[model samples]
Structure formats: structure tokens, C-alpha cells
Target: MSATVGSALAWWARTQPEQTAIVVDGESLDYQGYEAWSSRVAVHLRDAGIVPGDRVGLLAENSLPWSAMALGIIKAGAVLVPLNSRFKPAELRKVADDAGLARVIASDAVVAVAREAAGMGAPYEVTAFADVVGLRDAEPDPATDAFRVDREPTDPIAVLFTSGSTGRSKGVVLTNQSLLSIVFEASLTEEGFRQGSTSLLVLPLAFTPGLVWGVLMTTVLGGTIVIEKDLVPGRAVRLMEEHRVQAVFGVPLIFDAFSRTPEFAEADLSSLRTAIVGGAAVPVPLLEAYAAKGVTLRQIYGMTEAGGVATATLRHEAKDHPATCGYGSIFTELKIVDADGQEVGPDEEGEILIKGPGVTPGYWGDPETTAEVITADGWLRSGDIGRKDADGRIAFADRLKDLIITGGINVSPIEIERVLMGLDGVAEVSVIPAKDEKFGETPAAIITPSSPDLTAADVVAHCEQQLSDYKVPRYVVLREDPLPRLPSGKIAKPQIKQDYADVHVDFDKVR
Candidate 1:
């Protein structure tokens, strides 16, 4: 069987040609309709001298055209570089140049940013939506039975750039086999396709979890996908009711917003079966709340380098193990190893390492850095600390780089954040290490309150009851807005640390 993503997409198109494949806003496109448009886009790309293995940068928000363009690029056998639309002009330019892009497909909203990046004469051609989809009212190309080049399982499909704690972004190179492995694994475990299953695409497709698993997985399984440009709570509720969406994937923050919407309570969300929550730790209370609504909230834990998802709490286990990150997927092999590379026993916390078909080959153009993380034996050091229970369920601890060392004790920030998030009036919280002369470092809590009446002292007192004396925040900083987040919906901890470091305080005075 061919393992290429294009092959899977083609198979779905052939089997369900007239079935609805994508619905965006009010527009709908069936498999045949989408395939025809994708073919025309591929022909245009081929005519422009783009060849197999060439990188094509796609800069757009969640829209129908972006999905069409992605499929078109894959059919043309080119690597798709889905640049984050939130990136600034300079950041976009750096990614385009680094990937050695031959062409870029920019949406109307991002055309100006694309132009600014292309002005540097980076040897790449740029095309806006008007140039491709709106040019000359072109007719869709027929599905030609021409000779096509076969793709290996290892052929590069996409390059996802993820931010590092050291203030640099690393490009994780995903292949067709790796991406397909994740899609297949998710399908097998999640019961993704019943009869008329519909999935809502709320997260940005530029991110790995969204683009690779969220969108592409639905396509491969011949399921309908509802794409939304913005994640307004009202719009999400209306779309769910309008389309009878059965499954959805989102981060914790998105879930919170959806739950708080008045429309959510009134709308007919009974069609929703499974809601996969990840990107950040899911508060225990949030998990229980969603479960009360007849939606099974599965906690997924993975990173870009691992393709999409490594572990996910199964629907059956969602109610009991709401805090557990769950077991590894079918194709994924996860182990907790100590610093010396010895595998730790069950229930022991250690660095998480994964080895499987779902793991990416390595980072793009960074052999040294890649070698540092991906061992010679093919294990990718996840940089995350976790422990596996006897039942094979994995529970997340903290990122190795983000672990707080204070008073000769290593504290997992995730633990503190989870506890703090349960406090009354707290909307969001992030724990970081602050400079402390006595303990070398102390845990500091940066909190954003849902109400104006919340004060730093109130939060400190709340933590004093639950957390150990030392684990509680030595310093508290209240913010009016939520913390900065990455495109993946994970908190930008590096930026948070920097922001908190700028605050000068007397540790002795607080004590």
C-alpha cells in the first residue's frame, strides 16, 4: 500500500466523490468539487516550474482556500510550508528564506506581509488568492489519468516550525509516512468515522496538530470538515448546530470560551461525541465540566516533532482519568528515561522519549541540533517529564527546561499551574522560576484574573492551603489580560519569564 498522504486523499476522493468534504462559513465543497479545484491549482503550480520536493509556502488563516491549496500542493508532490499567519513580516521572511521556498500562496489578509517578505528578492515567486483562484474565472481541471510519480513513505510532506525555550524556532520536518501514521493511529483509537461524522476546524491549520491531524486526518477518513475563519464562541455554537458536527479538537482556552458561551448551553451540541483537548494542561475542573455536558474530553499530549499526538486519553477513560494524559497511540512507543538514558519503571517520573513511525525524521537544516535531541538509535528526546502508571496511562509533569529548581527541590510548574487554575477568580496562570538569593530560584506565579476584585494576596492565600509551603509562589504578579501564547495555543513561557524578570521586587520584603 502506498503510504503517501496524496495517495490517501486520492483514495478518499475516488470513494466518496460526491460527499461533502469541506464546509467554510456558508460555502460547501464535495470531494469531487474539491479534487477538481485542487487539480487546477496543481496544474498552475506545475506550469510555474515548481517540481517535486520544492517548498511552497502557504500563509493564510483558516479558510476553504487554504485547505484547497494544501491538497493541491500535496498532489503536485511539493513540500508545503504552512507559515503561521500571526507571524510578523520579519519572522515570515526568515521562515520563507530558511525553507528555500520556490513559491508562496498568500491569502488576501496576509498579502501585504507576503509582499514585504518577498521584497528581499529571496528567489521565490509570490501569488495571492486573486492570482490563483480568481484569475480569469478559470474552469476546474478534469481529473487526468496521467502518469504520476510515486512517493515514498519518507518523502517530506511539511515543515513545522516550533518555538524553543532558548528564544529560537526549530523546524520539524514531517514525512508522508509519519503524518499518515498519526492519522491512522488517531482514526483507530478515536472511532473517528461512523456514518455522518463531522469535525469542526477551530484551531489554525498552520500548527502541526491542527494541519496534520486535525484537518488531514478528517480528509483521509472521508469525513466532513467545517472550517471557521475565526473562533468566536457564538459562531462555533451556530456552526455546530447548523452542521451537526460530531467531533471537535481545541486547546483548553478554546474549550473554556466555548463552554462559557450562552449559545453553548442553548444550542443542540448533543451531536458532539468527542472533544480532544490539548496544547496545554487541562484543568481538572474544566475536564469534569465538559464531561457533564455529554462530551467526552480526551486529553492529548504530544509535540510537533512527534508528528501530532503521541498519547491521548481514550474516550472510555476520560471520565475516570481526567488528569491523565493517557496512553501512547498504536504506532507510538513512549518510555520514561532518566538522565543517564536508563528506562524508568512505571510510576516514576523521568524524561519522556518516543520512538515510532509517527516521530519526525529530524529538524530541517539543523543536523547538530537535531542530533542533540534525536539519538542515534532513533529515540526523540521529548524534553518533557512524565510518568506512566501500571495501566500504561501517561501523566504529564513538566518540560525539562521549564522545571523550577528552588531550595534544592525541583518543582514542576505544571503542578503549580494546575492547582492555581482551580482557584476562584483565576482565569489563567503560569508558574516560572524567579531569581532568589537564598534558594537560588523560587517559583513565581503570574496570574490573570477573570474578575477585577482578585488580588495577588488572595491568590497567595488560596495556594497556601493546597500547595506545600515551598511550592507556593514566593512572588505574585497579576495581569489584566491573558498571557502570551504561541501559534500552537501553548503558553509562551519564555516570553512570560522575560516579562516577569523585568519586575524588580525585594524577596526579603515578601517573606
Candidate 2:
């Protein structure tokens, strides 16, 4: 039988009618209750003249209503455009117009931003969650039973916009089957779900990792999800203790914050069986910190175009191999290809490419950009550089574009960042290429110190001992605060480059 998003929800509702499926803040919703609420939301959307193929925009934070709206949109056979809540009004307007949305459903916190975006003369209607649901309650849709399972597995479910290398954002199109393939594969793997398991949701749902891996995977596996308003380390620990959360998904930044919290030593985190960490390079020191707490930290590698997770460090191998991104998941096939697009041997670094059921068909409304990344033969060029060991474990190197070329020598920024992250005073670091007069480009380090006493000489001295001289940063810029971050939780390299472009100097001057 072909599986659809709506059918998956219906299956869970039948099997676990009374089981708690979602806990948003303090409110609980069992599978039966969730199904009913989703049906009502679907009825409301249809009444608002939303057709099966129509695009419905969701501008909200991570909440029960947000999840319900997503399910309802899919059940109604319409496409969901989840707007990034962090986007400014101008940015939001561009996305809404590009997606051709008919109506936007926004949360109370983000309603003003949505209103301003709507005021930009986009041909879309805006409504808040409170207003829509309140009206639905007063005159409950008798047409709630009108929902029909008309969508195919291949039907587009959601559109995710990602910032391009050139600064423009491209919309990635994800189909129901593509997302389900990931969930289904995860269920069949070693990290497969057990009934009644619980997962904590902290990542923003607008990001592919949060929407696909954090929420959809947990729900499909018959697991209960506990949603938090934001990822405050102290609050997250409390929620974990209160709900006995078994799985937690976070990025490196979240882990960094959690490691410093008193809860790292004081909280009872024995309920946590797996902690999936990704979005940036996971430092070995950070991995050891969590390992000491009896929590396994699995490094994952994924993107918006790949339905969230393409590779992850398996539970059994996580401790022994902290740096590896692990082997491919059940739904995908991974290949490391050289510059000529030919597959390379084991332990050889090259561009990581993926071909699988979880891969998206293409980007929305941009054939030129889509053709550049996805080939005609179906391989999705990840643009990330990596290598696979003899045992089939894949280790991440750096992004193809992020590689620093100094005196014609290529250096991986992630390689240097990982080493710097282990330094005594460094809290975070980003390495980028600085234009040079003689050499094409040279490496520059941007450091955020955990201790104020740390100096540029200290970072250079530490690197000189560990890395090659050419790979060592020529210039060091101290960041008094935490580095800027993209919505996906990774350090914003573009912003950092722009901020320090004028401070470039010779390595001898810093020495």
C-alpha cells in the first residue's frame, strides 16, 4: 500500500487513540484529539477557499497549532510554505510572493510581522491562529468530514527556502513520499523507533531538520513529542526531567550552551538515550562532555534539499568515532566523487553526493539553479566535501566553497575549527579565506573567546603546534560576543567575512 502523510496520521490515531501524541507547553493532545483538531483546521482552510493545489503559508513558531496546521495543510492536499519566523517583514514578503500563497496563518508573536508583510501588497490574506480557531469553535465546521485523501505520495508537501552562495534564497520543493522515505528508513534502521518513545523538540520547524527529523519522524514512529517555546538550556533540562524525554535533537550551538549549564551536572538526564547533534562541525571536546554525562551524541549531516538527514553517526559507533558523520541511512546511497565527478576510493576526500528516495525532486520555480545541484542521472551534488573510511564510515571535511586556498594549497576550515574548538580559551571559531596580493587567498581566523584573557598570539601559537604553517590563520579577529548565526543554527560565515574584510594583514605582522 502507498503511504501518504494523512494516512500515516490516521494509522497512529487508530492504534493509539488515547496515547499522548503531542505536548505543547503544558497542553496535551492525544492522537484522537490531534486528529479531530486537524480535521477542523482542514475544514476551516477549505472554507477559506483553499484548494488542493493552493499554497498556504505558515508563519509561526514551534507549537502544537503549528504542527496541526502542517498536518491539516497536507491532509487538505495543499502545499505548506513554512515562513521563517526570524525573517524581517521585507524578507517575509519576498518569500510569500515567491510561493504564491493564498493565505497566511500566523502565531500571535509573529502576527505583526506577517501583517506588515501582507501590507507590502502581496496578493495574500493574513489570519492569526487565535482568530481562525476562535471562529471555528463558535461555528464548528459541520463540513469537517469533507476531507478526502486525494494527494499522491509524489505530491509536493512543503517548500523550504535556503540562502544561496550568491546571497539569493532558493525555494526547495519536498514531496510527501520524499519525506516519508526518510521516516520509513529511519524506522527500519538501528535508530528505529520503539512504541511510546518520547522526543524533545527545540529546533525551529521552518528548518528542514526540525520539520522533517525532529517532528515528522517522531510522529510517524508512534513517539510522543514534547514541544518547547525556545531552546533555553536550563528550561530544556527541566522539560527533559519533567517529561522523561528519551531523545533530544540539537545543533552544536545548543550543545555548547547545554554543556555550560548547571543542569549538565545536576539534571537527571538518564531518560535520554540519544542526542542527535548537527548543523555544524561537532567538536570532539563537546562530544566527550556529553559522553561523560552518559549521553550519546550522534553527528548528523543533512540539508534542506535532502529531507533533513542524509547521514548520522550510529549509536554503536558514536563513542569510538566522534568526528565521523557516520554511514548512509537506509533510504539513501552516498558517494564521494572527485572533481571529474568520478567515484573515489575509500578514505579519499571528495564532494559528497547523494541519490535516494529522500532526495527532493527539484527546487521550486528555479530550473536553472535546480539543474546546477541535481544531475539528470538523479545524483544530488551536496557541495559538501567528505571521505569514507574502509569501514564505510563517512567523515566530513568542509564545504567545497569554504575551502581556503593559500599559496595554491587547499585547507579545510572545518579541520582548523575543530582543533581551535578544543583550545582552552576559544569558545567558537570560523575560518575564511582573505584575499591576498601575492597568493590568491589566505586563511583568516575569527575567534570568540571563552576567557577574556585569550589573545591572537595564543591562538596562533596553539595552531602552529598542531596545524601546518600555511594552514594556520594569517590574521585573528577577536569577537567580544558570540558569532552571528544563520537560521539553521550554523555560524554565519558570510556575515563574518563581510564584518572583518577590512582588517586583513600579513601573517608576520600578527606573529
Candidate 3:
């Protein structure tokens, strides 16, 4: 019953040595070999002077070595801090300073950036990931008992940085118990996500969903994971067909890209039973398209603080309540509350509060901010507005900070966004608040159109038919390029709001 991740890996290695543990770029690692390889890496880390509780930074792209080194760091009793590979040196230095990493291991592709970041942050040694793997291979493995470090269920396992789509990123601390709880919940709730199942991982491993479910927990479940570095839709389709991937967890854009690929039409996706999409709302058309291909695209909802997923639409509800994020997850308790902390009735919009073993203890080294979010007795304030239907399904409204208060009327941007997304030619839509002289703040839709001729007038005409007068976007900005996205693939709403803060729509010319 030990919740430590290392124990899980060891158990799998003993029980199913020949099982395929991970596949990256067509190369596979069996569970037995994976165990020994991770053990060697852990022995090397200890020899290199890494101690228990030390925060070790990992900066690398998605690869087999990156995955092995992560388990190695955790097995060595160190706190793993996975850094974003896309971060600039300045951004890297900022997180390096915050985490106060004792050492950083970078892959060959990013050694230079990691070195520069180390130089700028608090003094910490930097080592190449390739070097660690090489050294471990050349040296003989230490006794299995030699690297054993007693770890408690509450001991910190990793520090994951939030995507910061709305603001500055914070390091969310997760313990072994927290992650294990989620793994248990997911295995029980996600149909077809079980032992021996093959999963396709396209999201960056640094993201919570990718690391928690795709890598760490998948290993615990004795499942095989196909890793894709660059998200080529055709390539992803091929991998799924080849590996018979059953559980696919990705954002909406990823699935959308797969649907556009020619390979997707003929690909044998019958093996795909748990196609879960989170990070953003799953378009109904996209869901229907996947269903036509004999795949049910379920919408999942959760945050870093909740581990990975707190709720996900079940297969039975996917057709009728595609908009809902489904009921609370197995181990998670969800409740809707008003601004004054009073519980809201069903069908009432309020902040969603989650309490569960999967929820994080607190943010790393930021008790003040942690106190502001997590209540004393337990519940974590989700900072998301939603409504629970009488059927117990939760419908996401919008981020509390993204709500538009136009003419003193609270408007949910997600409502407008869901409407805009339904229009033909609109690929992605983010509804933000645009300053208006008459209404104070009007809803503005920033659209990334798939069709070349998609115009603002067309968007307006489409919204007018579906939305109420105030709910209709007053301004529409069409961008030729894709909208800015976080690592989790969610639109950067704060950035969009900041970028268009000065945008104005003539009230006299408005509807």
C-alpha cells in the first residue's frame, strides 16, 4: 500500500519484466531494463553528491532519456523539478532562483541554456543528461539496497510549474500520496486506462497532465506509453495505429489536428477507447467527428493543484452532456460556493471548490498565496466559475479573472467562446474584455480563423443569432497566426487581454 512512485516501478519490474514500459521514436524499453536503467541513474546521482530532499532541475525535450532521468532523480530521493524546454534563459533563471535547485541536468539540446541559467541563478551545478546516462552505463550498478532511501507518502516528489496562462507561474508541490491518489482515481474512472494499455503522449512531459498521467502514473499502472516529441498529426496517427494506443490524453488542438490529417480517416482507431481532452473545452463538432470514427472524446477538467484531473465526462454522458466536465472524480469532492463562501444550489453559477487526497498540500514556499486558495479545513478554491446541473454534472463557465463586467452585468467569456467556436471557419476563439465608453467593458472575440476569408463581420453575424444582445461580442479581431498558447495548450487569456486592452469599438456603430 506504499504510495511512493519508486515502489510502484519496482513492483512492476518484478511482476512483468518483459512488458514494454515506454516507446519513444520507435525504440522501446522493457520494464526490467527500465528498472535497472533507472536504478543505475539513481546510483550515479547519489555518487554525484545528490542528497535526499535536494531539488534537482531537469531541462530537456521529451525523450527516453528525459523519462528515465526523471525516475532516477525521484528514486535517488531528490525532489524533481521539470523545467519547460521552451523557456528562454531569463525565464529559466527566474524559476531556477525560485526553486533553489541543488543541481540541474540538461539534455544535449539544451545544455547551453541550462548552463547560462545556472550562472544567473543561485549557485548550482549543471550536468548534461547524456553524461549522466553514459556514466551510469560505464559503471557497475550498486547493490539494490545501497540506493534505498526511506521516503514517506507525504514527502515531496516533484515541483510542477503552472502554465501561467493568466499570470505569473507558481511552483505547485505534489507529494507521493497526492499523485498516487490521482493515479488510483484515474484507473478506476477512465475506461480502458489500465494495465497493459498503450497510451500516446503528445503533450510536453513538463505539463502536469503529461507527467502525472502519461509518464509517472502510467508506469505505475504497468502500461506502455508512446512518446511523440514534435506533434505531427500524421506521425501521431501512425504511432497510435502501430501501437494500438487505447488511452489518449491530449488537449483539443491536438485531437483537432489529428482529425485534419488524412491518416486519421483510415487509421485503425478502434483500439482507442479512452480519448480524454482537457485544458480547454472540447468542441461538439470535434467530439462528433471523433465519434463518427468510433472514438468517444471525453472532456476532463482539473488543475495542477488538483494533481491532474478532478472530473471527466463519462461515456454515457458524452453524447447528451458533452458540455459538462461530468461528476466529481472518485476521490475528489466538488462543491459550488458563492463569493461569501455560501454553498450554491444546483444550476447556480459559483466558484468550484475541490477537496481530495489528489489536491496538493500547498504551493512551494508560498504559504501566503497557498492560504488564499486552500481553506484551513481542506478545500482548494479552483478560481474557476461553474454551475452544477441537477444531474450532478459540472459545466465550466469561465475563469473568475476572465469574466467581463459590461454595464455591471457579469458575462462569462467561456459562454461567448463556446458560441464563437461553433461558427464555421473559426479555429480558435478567446473572448476577452474590451473597454467600451458606454458599457464600461464589452466582450471582444479574438479569433484564429481556419478559413482565409473569415471576417469580423461574419463572426458578428454568427454570434448575433446565438447569443443575447449583451452576450454578443462587440469587437472581433481575426489573427492570421495561431493564438498564443501555454504548455498545456490553453489559450493565454491574460496575454490576449493585455494585448487588446486599448482596443475600442465605436458604440455608435455597434449593434
lDDT of the candidates, in the order given? 0.79, 0.80, 0.85
lDDT (10s digit) by residue, model 1, range 134-153: 53245544444221334677
TM-score of each: 0.94, 0.93, 0.96
Identify the leading candidate in terms of lDDT. 3
- Candidate 3 wrongly placed segments (more than 4 Å): 139-146, 505-511
- Which lDDT tens digits does candidate 3 get at residues 305-397? 998788889898898898899888777888899999998999999999999999999988899989999999899999999999997899888
Per-residue error for 136 in candidate 2, Å, reads: 7.3
Candidate 1 TM-score versus the reference? 0.94
Off by over 4 Å in 1: 135-137, 140-150, 163-166, 191-196, 505-509
Order the candidates by lDDT, highest first — what do you get? 3, 2, 1
Of 2 and 3, which scores higher on lDDT?
A: 3
RMSD score of candidate 3 (Å): 2.0
Give model 2's TM-score versus the native structure.
Answer: 0.93
Model 1 CA RMSD to the hidden true structure, in angstroms: 2.3
Worst 10 residues of 3 by lDDT: 139-148
Off by over 4 Å in 2: 135-149, 163-168, 505-509
